[model samples]
Target: MSDIEFPDTLIALERAAWEELQAGRLTVATANAVQDAITQHAEAAGMSRVEVEMALKKAVRHAEG
Candidate 1:
């Protein structure tokens, strides 16, 4: 077993979320669907879908890494 410590911060949270997604806690398709939903919500609120997707991709990579 590894005894690695995770950092604490907004980035860390994003990383953790990513790790969960990678660990079969979430499926890639499900993540895409969730991102779609988030995009819809953000669009309704006049936000940027591209930005949201970028963040989502970043988190996903962290989890996958």
Candidate 2:
């Protein structure tokens, strides 16, 4: 993994998504919400939205394994 760092909001949002998934409540809508949150955070932080999205997707996939 790269040394890229995420903003607190993005990290919190990802954590929430993982929690929801663990709780068996991660619906498509919830996943979309997480993505939206990431977008918002990326914009606020002046970070690359694509990078953050990719990182979050990778995180979700890793969590599944």
Cα RMSD for candidates in order: 9.6, 3.9
lDDT of 2 by residue, 1-65 (tens): 43456666666677777888989888887778778887886787688888878787566546453
Candidates' TM-scores?
0.38, 0.54
Residue 16's lDDT in candidate 2: 76
Which regions of candidate 2 are displaced past 4 Å?
27-29, 41-50, 57-65
Q: After the best TM-score superposition of candidate 2, give how far the Cα of residue 15 lies from its true spot, in angstroms.
A: 0.5
Q: Model 2, residue 43: what's the lDDT?
A: 88
For candidate 1, list the clashing residue pairs, or say none. 18-63
Q: Model-by-model lDDT, in order? A: 0.53, 0.73
